[model samples]
Target: MQTEKIVNHIVSWLNNYATNAKVNGFVVGISGGIDSAVTSTLCAKTGLDVLCVEMPIHQAESHVSRGQEHIQFLKETYPNVRATIANLTPVFEAFKKEVLMEGKQDIVDMVLANTRARLRMTTLYYYAGLEKLLVAGTGNKVEDFGVGFYTKYGDGGVDLSPIADLMKSEVYALGEYLNVAKSIMKAAPSDGLFGDTRSDEDQIGASYPELEWAMMMNDAGKQETDFEGRNQEVFKIFKRFNNANKHKMNPIPICEIPNKFK
Candidate 1:
């Protein structure tokens, strides 16, 4: 579909879903990144009430400034838009105390990263439930259905990703089509876990676009994808993340009863 039509289609789909759901509004987390910018804008187009949240916890000044830029853009563009600021530092510390009690202090960075995500999720769901809104996700196709490049119970546990079918490149293109800010369109994608210029590439070792390209080749190019050459460096990264996070992409295990006994 054309970019305009695609944007309209997404907005329409969400609006219809919300109307049928009889919800109060739509809630989304804006991380000063492209995905959330595109999502909140799309939701605004449908005349639906949009809540854009900026969750910056102990971030540097630049982080706060960038998030404000996104918020400013959205406000200038939409009347029904409101960007809410929710800090998660205290919550992080409280939980850290509980973890120290357990004696497993290793992997603090990784654990804290995931903790931030889950905490954000809890806050979002609370607002979602109170407002009866659908929690719109910012995940792209590469991350959602492929390598699952998101925190499992945190960012990964979203209600719906409007851009789930679009690739990273396509997401930028649509952002342009929607007149999103240039800085936002060009900003590096991140989960803002550590505020250390982290990205999917830094965490997963391979960029999202490369992973999707690999998947495309595997689907269409047949056995050649298994052949040597193409960014072999990324192959290992993609496979490793996929394997390690299988549980996140799977259903809860229920042992099958082979016998018919009650």
Candidate 2:
């Protein structure tokens, strides 16, 4: 889709949903990443009230600064956009030491990373509730469906997803059309959940374009023939991610009794 047309469509969709739901505006957590930057800009384009939240939890100074810079850009560019910083570092540390690490069961780094995500989630909801706005999610198609890289019920829980259908590259294209900050557009994609500043590809074992291609192949029910097959590594990585996270991609399962049992 043309970037401008999609941007307009998303803006209209946000306004329509807010009107139907009788909500005040949108609430987006800006994570200093292109996805969040694009999503927040989309919300701001609607000219409705938008809360661009920066919730940092033991984050790098550079990441936090980038988030603040993005917020400043939004406030300057859009009159209706508002921003606030919520530092969750102390809260996260307390919860980790006093609660999660207190048990005999050893918690993994993934557990701590997920806790950070959930903390940010709660912070977003807190402001959303105060303003009677909906939480706008920033996940794209590759992470939300293809890799399931987001934290379920953390980043995954949202009132609306404006960019979920777009692939990662498509998001960058829209970011350019939106004139998103060059720093953000050029920065490597990261969840910022991990304490270190590793890029998403470092953790995912493949770039988003590769992952997107794998998802496309999986959807088409095609597989490798042999050494002649294309992107076998990509297909393998995609399947590994999809299989591990398939439960998150689907709705919660429940017991279904048979007619005879009933």
| lDDT top scorer | 2
C-alpha lDDT score of every prediction, in listed order: 0.78, 0.89
> Mind giving the per-residue lDDT tens digits that candidate 1 earns over 1-262?
4888888888888888888888866899877778888888888887778888877766655556766887788788889887687888887888878875443654767778788888888888887887778889888877776787788889887887789999888888898998887877777787788856777677777777888876676556434356566576666566666677778778879988778764
The CA-based lDDT of model 1 is what?
0.78
Model 2 lDDT, full chain set = 0.89
Query: RMSD for each model, in Å, please?
Result: 2.3, 2.2
**lDDT by residue (tens digit), candidate 2, 152-230:** 9899989999999999999999999988889898888899987669899998889988888888888998875532444
TM-score of each: 0.90, 0.94
Write out the backbone clash pairs for model 1. none
Q: Worst ten-residue run, lDDT, model 2?
A: 99-108
Error of 1 at 48 (Å): 1.0
